[model samples]
Target: MMRLERGSSRLYAMMLILAVVVLLADQLTKFWAVSTLSDSERIAVIPPLIHFRLLYNAGAAFSIGAGATWVFALAAAAAVIGILYTARRLASTGWALVLGVLLGGAVSHLGDRLFREPGFARGHVVDFIDYGPFVGNVADIALTCGCAAMLLLSLRGVPLAKTPEEETA
Candidate 1:
């Protein structure tokens, strides 16, 4: 059984806050895109590199499995569950933030899958940030950054938590 440290509550609260902030930002940006942009419109914010182009993605990243809406939904659900489990074990603020961002991103995309175009579970995710040949949303950015943070932490050998033996080492 894993026992949480005395300071874990504060970290957990921070994580929850981070998750909510990411969710709100993602939803707000997507809502704006959906309400303001036409399906065929592309607004360039940075020439040759970035643009705000509304895209309805029914698949996972990069448009792979383009028509597999249910598959993507399931994957997002699994990611949320995994994040929840990992969040409880997180011993550092960095891990908490990363998990929160990841969870928020998953939830944001899942919300679109349940409530956006088409119908529940078959709805498409609204993507607007277009850079190069790839189009993504705020949620995708959060997830990507969170994954990178996790990778960096792992490479630095940041102690997630000490094992029982290691605690005594």
Candidate 2:
């Protein structure tokens, strides 16, 4: 097994912390939405723009593949695994942060699918915060931001880790 250097360890710690924060925020907000909001009522935060409404989504974005909740659950599990695998060699702080947020959101959704109502591996995701087009939860926000950051970092030619050739140079 490749041991992490001190800096790499610190980066991993930061990533873990960020992921925990995102997971907590997502869960707490979902709890609040479930307790306070009603499915039948839309609480407008900004008239015709933003609203708070309870939504139980069993599928991916925009309710696509509604009938395949298990598929989404499996996909999320696979994504979490992939992210963790990538983290093993991470050498960039930016990548650490982005992956942390992404991991958190993915884990949150996976948890919802595995544990929350209906049945195991077929539970619906709790979502609120209507953005005039789609309703999503905190996890979605984190995922979106993380993805954007990932894209930006990639565009800037930031490497996730130093290649063997680069390290020797």
Candidate 3:
């Protein structure tokens, strides 16, 4: 087995911590949504703005490809795998945080898709937070924030440890 370097441990810890936080927040909020809100019911937090509206989505955002729930589940699984595969190389705190959020959101939604309702891999995601026509859960927000962070990090030249060849040059 390959031993992890000391600094890499920091990356692992940051990723795991953020991932767990997002997972718990997403799942707990989803539980609250299912228990409290009636299907398609909206409770306005701010009129004409934010609201809590329960919904079950069997597809990706905006119900796109509504019949492809299984595809999305697989996609989420792939994301989890990819993050784990690359996480060890994350040297910067910013990179670790960004990837952590992405990993967490992916795992949270994957849980719902795998175990919620309508059977495995076909289960719908419980979403309640509504911003006008757009409705989503904590996972979606985390994913969005993670993506935005990636953009910023990239623009700022997200660090890449020098390869042996580059180091020699």
Candidate 4:
């Protein structure tokens, strides 16, 4: 039991490290994109398949909101809070890792919205990396993968919530 506890501790540390690395990489890549690409301009890395297309998204994934920057910012904040709360409750290493990734990605994009273009929380998220029709960023990829991981875990019967009765039982 002691050994298992140690192992779990190590796993948690590893997950935290992975999250930090993801956040750093995402931020760095975004900085590069902002510095290199002009707004709304695309530089093709591979014609029609992959390109570094600079875009400002004032909405959720795929620019869903289109112009409601404040709403998106609020939503991102709520997501970050929810993820952090979930992370605190996570016992499984896999869940921790997934939450970490999701949190990191959220933080990265949220940072951009708070500090980048258009001013304060009214700012837009900078997105690049156009693969054919879809354009996203490193943070977006992390969020997607994290969400997928959580979904997979849920599908595989990994319990996400533990009630008081279950804990006592």
Candidate 5:
């Protein structure tokens, strides 16, 4: 295992960049989807593998809690705040990257929930990019992958706590 200094500056910088990139990419793609694709329209990019489509989801994953968009928005906002609060204890490179993407994804969805269409705090999220029967957006992809990475890291016993030096600080 590579020894990392407590409260590593480099890790934090990397995490910040990753977070910005994820957020920008998610929003930009959604903008592109809205401008280019009609609702429920699909354009196959690869046979049986990938396609582009436009969908508005006013619910959580798989359309769960379909009528509780505002509740989801509030939950997402809280998650973002919680992640930032825990970031100070971040130590591993793996954890940093995962958390960064998670934060970006959460915040991006929160933005859509707050600002995108039908009404405030109950706006639907713009989703595109389809894999067979599964449709999701950039933020969803990032969030899924990040969560998977965190799970794997945990399984491998990667510690997320700060070092002794950081504890003293």
Candidate 6:
């Protein structure tokens, strides 16, 4: 287990808050889509650009592995566990925010897989927000942005945890 430094509570607080907010936004939007939108009809938000088209995807982007919902569920569960484990050593606020977003996306997707239609661990993810060739939900957006930011941070050499000497400086 990693030991937390002084003021680490603030980092945890930020992470938790961001995660909850993202989760709520993703779920609420999906709820609204299910309640108001139709799988057979599309609502145009921007002609030929963006729109809302309800879809239950049983696979990853582009509907890859359409027959393997359980596999995706397992992957999402693993991602959630991994993020939580890494969060224990977080020292940078940016990393905290990014991980929180990633966690929220992963958890929301996992919830859908565990509770939505079809069956447990075989449920399809609720996807909307059509973008010409793609359709996905807020959780997907969060995950994409979080991953991009994480890559940027890593490229910049941001440490996940502060060293003992750095803590004293």
Q: Which candidate leads the pack in TM-score? A: 2
Q: Model 3, stretches more than 4 Å misplaced?
A: 160-169
Q: What is the C-alpha RMSD of each candidate to the true structure, in Å?
A: 2.4, 1.7, 2.3, 4.1, 4.0, 1.8
Model 4 lDDT, residue 71, Cα: 77
lDDT (0-100) at residue 15 of candidate 5?
A: 74
Each prediction's TM-score versus the true structure: 0.90, 0.94, 0.93, 0.83, 0.90, 0.93
Q: Flag clash pairs in model 3.
A: none
Q: What C-alpha lDDT values do all the predictions have?
A: 0.85, 0.91, 0.87, 0.77, 0.87, 0.91
Model 5 TM-score, 2 decimals: 0.90
Off by over 4 Å in 2: 164-169
* Decoy 6 TM-score against native: 0.93
Candidate 2 lDDT at 50 equals 90
Which tens-of-lDDT digit does each residue in 41-87 have in candidate 1? 98989898999999999888888887889888888899888777666
Kindly list the per-residue Cα lDDT of model 4 for residues 56-152, writing each as its tens digit. 7878877887678777777789988786555433457777788778878888888888887779988877789898767899999999999999999
* Superposition error at 137 for model 1 (Å): 0.7
- Which candidate, 3 or 4, would have the higher lDDT against the true structure? 3
lDDT of 5: 0.87
Report lDDT (Cα) of residue 84, candidate 4.
Answer: 51
**lDDT tens per residue, model 5, 8-118:** 656666676788899999999999999999976889899779999899999998888879999999999999988776666678899889988998899999999999888
Clashes of 4: 0
**Candidate 2 residues 25-122, lDDT tens each?**
99999999999988888998998899999999999999999899999999999989998777766779999999999999999999999999899999
Q: Give the TM-score of candidate 4.
A: 0.83
Worst 10 residues of 3 by lDDT: 160-169
* Pairs in steric clash, model 6: none
- Model 4: per-residue Cα lDDT at residue 63: 81
Error of 2 at 148 (Å): 0.8
